[model samples]
Target: MYSPVQPMHIPDGFLSTLVSIVFWVISIVVLGYALKRVGKDLGERQMPLMGVLAAAIFAGQMLNFSVAGGTSGHLLGATLATILLGPWAAMIVMTSVASIQALIFQDGGLLALGANLFNMAVIGVMVSYFTYTSVQKLARGKAWGIFTGGALAAWTSIVIASLAAALQLALSGTSPANIAVPAMGGIHMIIGLGEGLITFGALAFLYATRRDLFHVGEAAPKGSKAIWVGGLAIAALLAVLSPLASTHPDGLEWVAGQKGFLEAARAPLYNLVPNYVFPGISNGSLATIVAGIIGVVLVFAVALGVAYLRRGRKRSK
Candidate 1:
């Protein structure tokens, strides 16, 4: 559920060094494109909210919910962020979250940074963008429709990314295609439900509070009961249920175990650090709580820093 690094769950050595290097290159190129687009689309006021939204997404990811059996799932929050901030900004936020998780928690391998970014940032953000847009058109801005669309889009993106990872593993000969793809896809399908529900509820609340925020061709709106109360309620639910999330191995782990690659999976070098526990922090319930706090702080800092830089550059120009 709440693996220390969250979304970038492909374990160390899952993909070969060569494959990982290629993913890194692809991720950088895509990220640069996303940033350029975001810099142009987002306005000054949106920056602060974007920072808060990033922190919220990071924190939400740490709150794992039990799926089927002993398996667990957590919110990607990409769908929610994209619905609020649009795809380009969502990519920046998600990439920052993934980067911090890798650097601070050592959960995702640096070598696979590009792969992770591509999966979570590019697919999650951009694909969801189109999906939600289609849904919004169909729903015609109805709250329920928008919420449903966002949820589905978020869920779909995760499944697609999972498939992509499976393909990489198969191509690398780390595992057979027959074994890896379906196994990963099956588990992630279950996980995607949780992601959808979370995204839906968050978006619904945001829309309720700041209806203006969702308006086409306008700056993101500020404040309302929906924002404050909805956010609090969601956070409370996460805190209460996070500890009960699934203990079983996730999609990647399940594939690795079944395909006989689990043994060959080398732990990242950085993971040798004392703090690099799979469960992270204390291996207790508090682990998620602590991780959530850390995630919130890290995302806030990174988002603010990015926003500040963008603003400074604009002012100079």
Candidate 2:
């Protein structure tokens, strides 16, 4: 489902330097605005939840499963975040996770961090959030409304992100539109199925067990047996399923290969914790599991720090 090192992340050379820089500027501006406004109006109570939800997203990505045709994909969790925390908070959380993945885990390239965030964080959240809200409006009162909204948004996020990446790669001269678009779009359609089902299932689970958490200002849902089960399930996936996940490269990597630009991907400058390995973890399976767990914790701390800072600002002002 994941290459462990690269998943859907755009590597350094995949995008032109100018394109990367442009996205960096855009992403930073959006992130700055989100940090100042996202949860500020909701009060500080929802801050810590940013960390907890980011951890769940990190864990969920590690459990990527097969879709079809030897291709696989992982969760972006943008819709899930938007559903529980609103669009602004969801964008901040996704950006935080992507930044951490690029720097600490080397899951994405430093130069391309902007593009990565632009694709998976900004675009993913915007498309999913709008889609979910529109669907929710039309499907009100039905038990399936929430789940269907989640599924549609999740699926669209993947397809839209994939198309965006393909266009960027073409503009960067890494791949031609004819080859890149069709290949990327086709595979991601299947991958989106997995993302949609998982997202819908997750939404259903949350609504049933943690409905209090649906809105940003409400009290945090108390930890129940279901919460424990969900936590354990996430842990089990990292410890067990991550190691057993399909070894094939995910959708982006596969498309790169098919479009004859796989080698266009270059390594990051420092490669800190390259391939998500904790230096000296020689066992491939063990490294994957350990790396995933470490990444989850790292992102958790990052989100927590951001939340704390925001809370402090609110308290002072």
Quantify all predictions' global Cα lDDT against the true fold.
Answer: 0.68, 0.71
Off by over 4 Å in 2: 1-7, 65-73, 216-317
lDDT of 2 by residue, 1-317 (tens): 44455435888888877668878998788667667776465567667888888888887888777757776666778888877777777887898788888887788899999988977887777777666766766876465778998899898777767766766676566766657666666777777888899898888898899877666334332222332243234333322322222232244345444643333344343364465455557678888899899999999999999999999999999
Tens digits of per-residue lDDT, candidate 1, 165-212, equal 766676455766666666776767777888888887877787778887
> Candidates' TM-scores?
0.64, 0.65
Write down the worst ten-residue block by lDDT for model 2.
Answer: 240-249
Give each prediction's root-mean-square deviation over alpha carbons.
Answer: 17.3, 17.7
Per-residue lDDT for 174 in model 1? 76
Q: Would you list the clashing residue pairs of candidate 2?
A: none
